[model samples]
Every structure is written in structure tokens, then in C-alpha cells.
Target chain A: MIWRLAFATMLVLAAADKRSGYQDASPETRAMQDDDASNPGFLWVQQGETLWAERTGNAGRSCADCHASIRGVAARYPVFDARLGRPITLAQRIQQCRVERQGAGPLAPDSDALLGLTAYVGLQSRGMPIQVSIDGPARPFYEAGKALFETRQGQFNLSCAQCHDGLAGQRLAGSVIPQGHPNGYPEYRLEWQGMGSLERRIRNCMIGVRAEPFAADSPELADLELYLGWRANGLDVETPAVRP
Target chain B: MMRRRFLVLTGSGLIVPLAPMHPARATPVQVAALIAELVGDATLRDERVKLDLPVMVENGNSVGMTVSVDAALGDVRSIDVFAEGNPLPHVLRVRFGPRAGAPRIATRIRLATSQTVTAVAKLADGSCWRDRVDLLVTLAACID
Candidate 1:
């Protein structure tokens, strides 16, 4: 009976820790939210809306001509892509669209086109909770990512858990370190001069850990992104989110 | 003070063999002067710019950042990015049109080493806004 009570207490503490800050790891979203009057995602969405209609490459096929409206498309991303036998991020899917449908070359991993399209698609699911499925094939990818997150890397000898999981909401230097959530992506990073992809952002963190950055389309990044998406399961997609 | 490496361009199209330098020397002043030359007629304020950077970074290859100003985007016409001790001081320049909604940007960058990062914003009225952040880099990330 005493052991059971101790276990229950530990579980409660863990739950409270997660509730307090780990859920929203990125900088506060409110600062970037310009109200309903000015949606930052609006700009990227307009660009994507245009691209969806415009034909490209030799085939001259536009993504919009076939799929048509993809209003809720964003919330379903980082899905278990059957062919790859792993979870695929929205950026990966967008690249596939260009390569398979349009027969065009893959955009540079974090290229502006990829970021723009990812932002565009992500906005379609704005205000909807990110609902990546972790049940089937996605389970393996999530597991792989979780392992990677806990693994320490580079000369810093720090794991992703150190800052995001362990010390989240605490000040590192002067900035309030966020929990490292993946909900807001295809974000318009102020320093980037334009839109940015989750891949690039993930790569940024890799560098922070002093780990060598994987190639833009590397399997590792895909797995890591899947894991992060699953972790942020119920959070709404806030693509083109502003960060500071 | 920041550390700087003298960059030698190699045949492989890569920068090689980083040679360290003193930040308090003439290098940063020259960089500042060069920036001043690039942006003419704008005032440099000690207050208006707010630069966010880490206090201690293990690597210089990727440094997180945030920059903002209290002024409206319409009132501002230009912005520039500078790393006082990096190999190249002029990182980027942004010119805004009337439709440019905001004057804030947050992104990641490469700092050769620990140093002060500054952003100078020039308004349409010929006034200057400047912000500086002291970043502590424990391990320089850009070893290559």
C-alpha cells in the first residue's frame, strides 16, 4: 500500500511537469499572433494558393488541379507514409508532390519553395489540433526519434532533453527557453528573410547540440520530425508561426 | 570582446585554417565604419534595437537569434545584420516597401565565435536604431 502511494505521487509530479511547460516549447505564440486582422500565415497561404494553381515543369501539372482543395490537409501531416515505412513530415510530402506529380527536381531541402509550400499547406489546418497518427507504422519512427532525442551528441555532451525536457521555461542566457514543440512550423523566421521549413529548424537545433547536421532529406530528420509531431499531438497547427 | 579568424579562400571553394584575432583591436571598428559607409544618413541609436542572443553557446556554427524594434515597419525603411567578430560583418540588408507589414525578424545564424551581435535599423526619417547583444560562446561551433 505504501509503495502504491509513492508510485502515484511520482506519476502526479511527472504529469504536472509536462503540463506546466513541456507542451509549448517554442517561444510564446501570442507575440507572433497579429490578431485575426493580420494572420502572418496569410502571406504564405496566398503564395501556396497561387502555386497550387500554376503548372510547373515539363508536365505542366499543378498540385491544385488534382487534389483541389486541401483545407484540413495540414493537421494530418507527419503521417505514417506506408511506402517509406516511417512517418513523413509535411515537408517531405511536399517534396514528393513535386518529384512524383510535377516530375520536377526536388527543391533544396530547406529551399524557399519547400518552405513556402509547407507553410501554405500547414496553414490549411490552422487552428486545428495536430493529429499525427502514431498507432501503425508511425510508432517505429516515433520510437526512433525518442531515442535520438535522449541520446547525447557532439562536444557539448548534452541531449535534447537537457534544455527542452529538463529545463524548459527556464532562462538560458536571457531568453526563456521553450519546450521544443513542433506544432508551429513552416514558420516565417525573421532572420531568414522569408519562410523556413521544420527541417531547417531541426537542423538548427542539431547544430546547437554540436551534432553534425544531416542532409536536408535525411531519414534521421524525418524520424525526428515524426517524433516531435507525435509529441505535440493535440496542439493546433500554427504554421508560419513567428519566433524570436 | 569577440574572437575572429583570418579566412583564407581555398581552391575547394571553402574557407580554411581559422586564425584568431583580437576583437578590441581595429577590426571591429573597421567593420563598424564599413557598415556606417554602407548605410548613409541614418542615425545610430543605442536604444531602439533589441537583439536577442545566447549568453553561452557551445558552437558558433548555429546561433539562435531574435531582433526587433519599437518603431512601426512603415516608419522604417531599411535594416542590416552584423556580427562584430565574424569573418564577414555584412550578413544581410533588408529594404522595406510600404507593404512590408512588420520590422521584426527571428532566425538562426553562424557566429564564428562568441561576440556581440548588432542590428541597425534605419528609418525613413534619417534616424537610426541600434541594438546589441553580448553572446557567450563556450565552444566555437564553426570549426571548419
Candidate 2:
């Protein structure tokens, strides 16, 4: 009972201390993300800005033609899709809109064009607190995501919670692990040498643990994205964040 | 430490053997030679310049760098940056205008490995000043 209570107390404290990765990042990295001139991620944003206005597909429609009021749109992502009856990540939403709505070809998962668009759209919600709901139809996916977050797998027999939740701010080899918040995504990682989506980073982690990574368009990743989004609730969206 | 040599023809039609340039990146000797070529017969000093880079870097992909000079900021005409362990040693060059303010620039560069990053500032009179910082770069943890 005492151990359970101690764990519960720790949970309460951890919940209250929901810090974004930016808060944990070094000052140099912070400066890079803070300054548009120095941050390399802005290069992707620039590409995205170009793509937004360019007409494409059989419909020859542009993203700028339709989604004019996209401010704060990225913050409320991994939202419940009524047609799909499941949660859809922002990237998936863009893919869906590009194909079905705009009559365009499906962009390859994690492509620069796709990442550029993601970064571009995500930039609209910068400084806006993440606001996703786990209510009603979204609850089941959220539960699945929560389960996956806590599930132990791979050769290391580690769960996302073990390191991200329990050992955050602590050193693992040469890296200081953050809480695995998905706030700053399509972020420029020094390791990646380019911008990458949250899904790609998630898959990277899965592979890091020697586990089978979920498919790019897999429902599991969407579920996981939902969970991470929920976990990172209230943190400002830091699109195109620079990370070491 | 590793190097590859190359031959260059002088303007007077004389072939001269320059310092060894690494097959992939620039070695210290090659970088020094490049700096010498840029400075020509002008005086080169180890003062009036500052190279700001992290002493230890986690990854070599994108390292932020800041270069500055002493009080003679306005007369500074240009600055050249060289990385000792990158595929290309001369990473960046910034030429300042007459109306340019304090001689300071912040930029990001990719390092191939752990090595010294050198920056040289050329004044209007052709005199050059420099500073260098040696940084240790470690590999990434999430090696997927």
C-alpha cells in the first residue's frame, strides 16, 4: 500500500510538471529554434510556403485556396475523424485532404514535401497550447495509445514510460532524455540532419528498442500520436523545433 | 590526421605541390595552407578575433557557430570559417559592407567529426586575425 501510494504521489507530481522538450533543451538549441535566421527547420517551412500556393492534382487546387483560417489548427491535431471513426494525426489529415478533398496523389510518407507541408501547417499553431480531446469516440484510441505507451516490448524489454517518464532529465549514454513530448515535431534533429515528423521519430524510437516499427499510415501510430498529444496537452506547439 | 595531396598550377605557369588535402575533408595542414593563400603576404595575427562554438557537441550534423572580432569591427572586410574535419574545410565566408555594424555573425555548420573550427577576419588593409575552437563531438544515442 505504501509503495502504491508513493507511485501515485509521483504520478501526481509528474502530471503537474509537464515540461516540453524545449524547456529541457540546451540554450544553444533553444536559440536556434528561437531565431528564424539561424534555425535550419525554417528551410522546410519556406518550401512548404511555396507548396501551399502551388496548384496541384486533377482538381488543380492549392492548400491556400481552402484552409485560410488554419491558425491554431495544428494544436488540435490527432483529432477524432467522424468518417474514419478513429483518431487521425495531422499528417494523416493532410494526406486525406490532399487525396480525397483536393484530388491529388498521395504523398509518400515522411517525404520532404510532406514534412515541409506539415512544418508549414504546424507553424500556424506555434505558441498555441496543444488542445486535444480524449472524449466520446476518441476514448478507445486514446486507451489503446495509453496501453502502448506502458507496454514493454523489444529486446531491451523497455516501455516508453520506463525511460521517458521515469528517467527523463537523466543521462542515457551522452543524451539527456526528455519526457518524449510530441509538441515540437517536424523538428530539426542534429542526429537526423533534417526535419522529421513525430511519426518518424516514434518509428525511430521503436527501431531503437529493436522492435517492429508500426507502418507510417498504421492506426497504431495514429493512436500513439493521440496519446502523446494528450500527454503534451497545454504545452505550446513548437513546430520546426531544433533538437540535438 | 589523415590526408590526400593535390597539385595546383600557379598564375605564372609554375606547378606547385600544395599541402595534402584529405580525400574527404580538410586536414589542419590543408586548412593552414588555404588560410595562407587567402591572407597572401599580409600580416596574420592570433588576436582580435573570436570563434564561439560548443566545446563539446552531441552531434556533428548542425552545430551553431558565432564569430566576432575586437574593437576594429567596422574596418573588417570579411570573415572565413574552416572546419578541420568536414568533407569541405572552408564551410562559410561572410563579406561585410561598409555600413556593416559590429563584426559578429551567427550561423550553423555541419561537422564531419571532432575537430577544431577556425575563423579568420580580414581587415580592409589586408591584415588578417584569427581564432579557433576545438570541439569534441559524440555520436547520437538513438542509433536505429
Give each model a TM-score: 0.60, 0.83
Pairs clashing in candidate 2? none
Which tens-of-lDDT digit does each residue in A5-88 have in candidate 1?
A: 454345335633433122332332344444433445557767777877789876789888778677878887778887877777
Model 2 over residues B22-134: C-alpha lDDT tens digits? 35777899998999999999988998899999987876777888999885656888899999788789988997766667788987788877899899999987788999998
Global lDDT of each model?
Answer: 0.66, 0.82
Task: Give the TM-score of chain A, superposed on the true chain A, for all candidates in the order listed.
Answer: 0.84, 0.95
For model 1, state the Cα shift of residue B12 in Å. Answer: 40
TM-score attained by chain A of model 1: 0.84
Best by lDDT: 2
Two-chain DockQ for each candidate model: 0.06, 0.25
Alpha-carbon interface RMSD for all candidates, in angstroms: 11.2, 15.6
lDDT per residue as tens, model 2, A107-139: 898899999999999999999999989999999
Worst 10 residues of 2 chain B by lDDT: B1-10
